[model samples]
Target: MAKNGKKMETQRSVDQEVKAICDIMRRGNCAGAMQYVPELTWILFLRILDEMEEQERQAAEAVGAAFAPSIEAPYRWSDWAAPGSEFRTELFEKGQGNVFAFVNGPAYGEDNKTSLLPYLKNLEKRPNATAKQKVISEVISGVDRVRIDTERNFLDVLDKVDAITSAAIDDTHVFTLSQVYEGLLLKMGEKGNDGGQFFTPREVIRAIVRVIDPSVGETIYDPGCGTGGFLAQAFEYMTGPKNEKIKSADDLSVLKRDTFWGREKDNVVYPIALANLILHGIDKPNLWHGNTLTDQVGYGGLFEGAPPQFDVILSNPPFGGKEGKDAQSKFDYKTGATQVLFLQHVIANLKKKGRCGIVLDEGLLFRTNEDAFVKTKRKLLDDCNVWCIVSLPGGVFTSAGAGVKTNLVFFTKGERTKRIWYYDLTDIKVLKKTPLVSKHFDEFFKLLPKKEESELSWFVDLDERRKKAAAEASPFKKEAERHARAAAQWNEKLKELKKAKPKKAPAIEKAEAKQKAEAKAARLAAGKAKEIEDAVYDLKAVNPNRKPEVDTRTPEDLLDLIEAKGREIAKVLFALRQ
Candidate 1:
C-alpha cells in the first residue's frame, strides 16, 4: 500500500510539471526562448524510456518470460545524473553522433544494458556540471518512481515536457524583452539597411490581408518578406481554430511548412523572420536570405518558368533607391534599377490565375519613363483582373519619417478586367501625431463595400471606357473640349454680373413730394419680372442649361435678345445708367 501511494504521488507530480511547461512555452518570449532548456528534452525522454524498459523486465521476471535490455547503461538519465563523477565530460567528448548512438542503443533495445553513458558524460564537462547533475538526478529519480503506463498516454507526458521547458524559459516575459530589443534597433536609426522602407505599417498589413483573403493550403509568398509580419498574419488567419470544422490536419501541415515562403535581403531582418515564424507556430519555415528580385534560388528565371507559383502574392517592396549601372544592366525590364524591377518581378512570380495585392507609390499608376515598363504594366492589367486601388492617408509612415502617399492595388492574373474598384481612403482623416495606430484601418474597413455595393462607393468600368475611346477615336479630346466650354461659360456669366447697374426710384405724388419714396422703382420692376418668370416656369423647370446657352452666344445675339424682350427691362436699366 505504501509503495502504491508513492507511485501515485510521483505520477501526479510529473503530470503537473508537464502542464506548467507547455503553458510557459505558449506565453513566453519568442526570441531565444528555446535556448534555456536546450538539453532538457533529451534527458526527460531518456528517463521515461528507461522506466518502461525496466517495467517490462520486472513483469517478464515475474511471469518467467525471457527479457532483454534495449538501451545501453551509460546512455540512461540515471547514469548521467547519478552522483556524477566524470560522466558529463565523457558525453561531450563523444560529440553529437556518439550521443545519438548511446541514447538509441541499450535502454531502447531488446536488451536494456546500454546505459545513458552519453548524457552522463556530457553533464560532467559542462560548466558547473556538478550542480546541474545534482538537480537533474533528483528530478529523474522522482520521475522514475512513478509506476504509470506512460506508453498508453505518452502525449500527456510529452505535453508536460513541452510546457515545463517552455515555462523555464518564460516566453511571456521574453516577449517584453523582444519589444525592448526592437525599440533599441529602432533607436539605432540605421539607414541603407533599408529598415525604414522595409517596415510595413501593421494597419496596412491587416488591410492587405483583409482584401486578399488568402485561404489555407494555398502557397502564400512575400518576396520582400520584411520581418515576416505578413506571412505571420496569413498563418494566423489559416490556422485559427474558429474554422475547425473546415480546417484539417493536412491544412495545418501545409501552412506550417509547405504553403509559406519568404525572402529577405537584409541580414538584419533575416533573424527577425525566423523569430516571427517560430512565434507564429511555424516550426519548419521555408525562409531564405537573398534579394528575391535578383537571386537565382528556388526558381531561376528572368520572367518565364518561375518555380512554385503562388496563389497569393503580397509585398511592400523598398521604395526610393537608385540602382547602379551594373545592377540596372542585370534587369530584363527597361526601368533597370528602380523599385519598378520589384513590381515586374512580383508579376513574373505570380501564377497565371493567382491574385496579388501590393503597396506602391501613387506615381506607379501614372508614370511616363521607360515606355516598355508602362506598356508591360498595361498589358498585364489588360490580360488580368485589375480589381481595386485604395489610396492611403498621408503620414501613414510617420514612424519611418517618410510622408509619401501610398496606394494598395488588388489584381488577379488571367481575367479580363472590365472595371477597377477605387477607394479614396486619403480624404479620410487618419493621423493625429507622431505615431500612427491601427484605428485608421478600422474606418477604412468599415467603409469598404462588399462585392455588391450599396453606398459610399462606385466602380469605374475601364473596358467600356476603352471601347468607347476606340469607337470615337478621340474621346479624351472630346472630354477636354467639354471642360473648356464649361470654363468659358462661367467667365461670361461673371462678366455680365460685373457690368449690371442699380435702378432709380419711381416718381412720387406731388402732395407726398416732401416724403422721399422709400422703395426704388427699379426694385419694383425687377420683382415684377421675377414674378412673371416664376409663373411662366415652375421651380423644377428652371433650366440649368440656360447659363451655358446664354454665355456661349456672340455679344450681338445677346444684345438683340435683350431688346426683343420686354422694353421695361431696358428702360429701367437705361434710366438708372443716366
Candidate 2:
C-alpha cells in the first residue's frame, strides 16, 4: 500500500509540473499555446529522451552488454540544461576560450562545434547513425533557436520539464503527458493553424483504430499523419489487454521500431508528430517528412526506399483543399481536391489484402456529376471491398476546425465491393460544445458486420444498384402501375362481399369465420412478400433522374395499404364460402 501511494504521488507531481510549465510559457508571452507547445515539445522531448537513455544504459549494464549512447556527451540534456553545471560553471562562466561562443552562438559548428543547431543538423549525415539519432536531428533541424526572450523564463521551463522523471515512462504516467500534448495540439487545431489539415479529433481517431483492429506484427501507416494520432492509437490498441498477437520481447521491439510509419507535409507539425509518438513509447517511428500527395521521384529519392506498403492504414486526410497541378499530375484520375489525391495514394500504396479506415467528407460518396469524382469512386469499388460507411453527425468536427459532414469508410484491398453498408448519424445533433462520443457509434458498430436494416442503417448492393442506374429512364413506372391495379381489384371485391346477405344458421357462420382466419393468414404473408419486393423498386424512384412524385409513398407506407386490403379480401373469401 505504501509503495502504491508513493507511485500515485509521483504521478501527480509530474502532471502538475507539466501544467506549471505550460502556464509559465503562456505568461512569458511565448505567442500563446500554439507557439509555446512546439517549444515545450522539444524541451520535453530532449528531457524524456535523456531519461529513457539513462534507463537503457542502466539495463544494459545489468545485463553486461556494452551500450553506446545516441547523443554524444557534450550535447546530452544533462550537459547544458542544468544551472551551474559542468559546461556552465567549469567551461563557460570563467571566460574559457570559445566555450560560450561555441555553445549558443549562430555559426557553422565546425572544428570543435559552434552551437546546438549546427551540431543537430550535422548528425543527419553522420556515418553509421542510429535511427534514434536521426529522429533527434530531424526534430531539431526544424526548430528555431529558443524564441523565449528572457533567460529566467527559459531556465524555469527547463526546471519544470526536468521534474518529469524517468518514472514517467511507465505506461500509466506516460499517457498523462500524451494527453497534455494532445490538448495543446487541439488548441493549435482550434485556431486553424495550417488550415487545420492535420488535426483529427481524438474521439474520431479512436473509433477508426478500434474498427481497423491492427494486429501486433502488422505494419500501420498514415499518409497524412497529423501529429501521429492514428499511429499512437494503433500502438495503444496492440499493447492493450485485448491484443494476443504480441507475445514476446522481440515482438514488442518490432512494434516499437518498425510497426508504425507515417508521412507529414507540414514542417511545423512534423516535430509535434515525432514528440507525440515518442511519448506513446515508440522508440523509433519511421515518419518521413514530405508531401504524401506528390509522387516519389525514384527509388530512395523522396521516400527512403521504394514506396512503403502497409498492412493497415488509418487516416483522416485534409478535406476540400485543392492540390497543385504537380500533385494532380501524379494520380491516374487527376483532381485538384486534396482528399482525392490522398484516396488515390492510399489505394495504390496498400499491400494486397491491406485493410484501411479513412475519414472523408460526404461529397466523395454521392458526387456523380464530375468525371474525376465518378472515376475515383469507381476505382475504389473495383479495387477494394468497401464494407462499411458510418456517416457522422454534422458539426462533429467543428471543434477541430472542421464543420463538414464526414463519414468513416472501412475497406480492404484486393476484393471488388459487392455491397456497401451505410449508417447515418446525421440527425443525432453533434455540436462544437457537445460533440460526438463513442456512444454515438454504438449502434453503428453493432449493425456494421450484420448489415441489418434499421431506421438509420441500410445496404446497397452494387450489382443491383448499377442496373437501377441504367434503368433510370422509367425504373419504377411498371411497378407503380401493377400495384395500383391490385389495389383497385381488391377494393371491388370487398364492396361485393359487403353487399351480399349473411347466413342465418349458427353452424354455417362459425365455419365461415374459420375459413376467413385461414384466408387472412395467407393474404398477410403474401402482402409482406410483395412489400419486400417493392422496397427495391421504391429505391429506384430515388434516383436523381426519376421524379419523386412518381412514387411519393415509401415502401413501409405501401405495405400498410397492402395489409389493409388483404383483410378486406379475406372477408370477401368468407362470404363466398357461406
Candidate 3:
C-alpha cells in the first residue's frame, strides 16, 4: 500500500521505501549524506547478515553438521529488530522496555546484560572468535551509540529498511540489495559533495571490468578500494549467469573465501567497504585498513594470510593526492604525487604474465620534466606489454567533482612493450547530464582484436620510435662526453701550472682560457643531448591519422560578436541599475 491510499508497483515501492529511510535520517540528527550513509550502512549490513546467517544455519542443519552462529540472540536482528520480535513488542506495549536504552546504555533491564554497541565492540577480544565476529567489531568500532537522536525516528527507519528485501522486488526488475546501496553511494558522490572524492562512476568501473575480464579462480585486488567498487564489480562479472567459464566446487570455494583483496586508509570509508563487499556476497574480503603507500597498518586481521602478488589488478586510486617524504622514501622512483607512486606499486604487485587495468591522469603520460614520473613510465614500458591506451572525455569524472582528463591503461606483465594502440574519445562531448557510458566503448573493444587503425584509433611502434631517437641522440651524446673529458684535463693542467709556478703567469692565464672554452662547449653539447633524451621518453597520445580541425571564423566576425555581446550585457546591467 502507498502513503496516498493507493497501491504502487514493486520497483517503485522499493525505491520509495529506501528513500523514505533517507528522509527520516535527514530529519534526524544524521543530516548530511556523509553522516547518514555511514549510519545507514551499519544497519543495512546487520539486516542482510542476519538473513544470510539464517539461510546458512538451515543448510547446516539439513546436512547434519554443527554450526555456530556468528551473532547470538538478543543482539541479533531477529531478537530485537525484526517486526513483532520480543523487544519491539515490549517497547510498544505499555512502555515495558526501551529500545534506545537497550541498544545504547549500561545494564537497563532485569537481565542486566551489556548494551549492543559495547557487545559488538568487544567481540574481537573474545578468545577464538570467528572471522565474521572480527569484521563486525571493526565495522562497529567507532559507533559508540546510534546516530538517530530520537527513538521514534530510529524505529521508523528500521521498519522501512526491514521492508526492503528480495521479496519486495519483482523478478522482472532484476534488482538487488547491492543495487539499492549503490544508489546511496551515487548520492554520496554527486557534485558539491565532499564524499565525491572517494567514489568512481559505476559506468567507468563496468567498462574496465569488461576489458579486464577476470576469471573465476583468479585473485583481484584494489590498493585504494574506495567502498570496494572494483572488487565487488569483479565478483559480479566472474559469477554472472552469462559467463561461460565453468565453476568447479573448489573454484567456488576459492572465489568465496580467497579471491578478493584490498586496502583502504580512511576511517569511515573502510568500514563501509567491508559492509559493501559482504553485501555483494563476498564471504571473506581480505581487506587491510591502512595506507598502502606508507605501509601504516591500522588493522590486518582480515588480510593476515594474503599472498605476495595477485593475478589481476583493477583500481582507480585517489587523483591529485600528494604524499609526504615518509611515503616517498619507500619507492625507488620517488615522487610526492600519489598516482605516480601507486603506478610503481601496481607494477611491483603483479605476478608473472598477470594483467592490469588502471585509470591514470593525462598528465602522467606526457610528463617528462619530473624524473620520477619519466622513470616510472620507463619501468612500465620495460616491464609490461602496454597494449592499449584509451583517452576518455574530460567530463567523465565531472559528476564525481573531478574535471581532470583521464585515460584507461591496459597492460600485461613479463613482457616489454613494442607497440601501443590508442583509442581517442576526446572529440565526443560529455556533460553532467550526458556522461561517458559503456556503449561508448563498444567500438573500442570491436577494434581491439587486431589493433586496427581507424579515424579514432591508431597505433605507435614504441621500439622503432625509441630506436630512431637513440640513433639521432648518439652523435650529440658522444660529442658532449668528449668535451667534458677535455674540460677536465684542461682544469687539471691549469691547477698543476698554478702549483708549479707559485705565482700568476701567462701559462696559468692561457690554461684558464682553454678550460673555460672546453666547459662552454660541453654545456652546449649537453643541452642539445638533453632535449633529444626527453623527447624519447614522451609517451603522450597524439593521433597522427586525425588532422586538427581548423576554425573558419574571421577576426572581424569574432570581434563584432564580442562587442555585441558586451553591449547586451551592458544594457542588462543598466536596466538593473535603473
What TM-score, over all chains together, does every model reach?
0.50, 0.75, 0.91
Q: What lDDT does each candidate get? A: 0.53, 0.72, 0.85
User: What are the per-residue Cα lDDT tens digits for candidate 3 across 1-578?
Assistant: 24443433566676777788999999999887888999999998888888888889999999999988888877898888877788667756646237877787665477778878788878877999878888898888767778898888988888877666645555355467787888888878878776777888898899889989999878898999988999989988888843344467677678878999999999998998898889888888889999999999999998988889999999998778899999999999988999999999999999889999999998988888888988999899999999999888888888888888899899999999999999998887888889778788888889988979999999888898788878888888889889889999999998888889467698899988988898889888887876776676677778888987899899999999999999999999999999
Weakest 10 consecutive residues, lDDT, candidate 3?
1-10
Sort the candidates on lDDT, descending order.
3, 2, 1
Model 3 TM-score, all chains together: 0.91
Give the winner by lDDT: 2 or 3.
3
Q: In model 1, where do residues sit more than 4 Å from their true spots?
A: 1-194, 241-246, 296-307, 325-332, 429-439, 442-456, 468-578
In candidate 2, what are the lDDT values of residues 380-465, reduced to their tens digit? Answer: 88899988887777787787667887888899999988887777777788766776788888887787667787777777787786
| lDDT agreement of model 2 with the native | 0.72
Model 3 spans > 4 angstroms off: 1-12, 91-97, 106-112, 241-246, 505-517, 520-524, 550-578
Count of backbone clashes for each model?
Answer: 51, 1, 0
Best by lDDT: 3
Model 1 lDDT tens row, 403-466:
6778887889888778766665554554534344566556556656564332323466666656
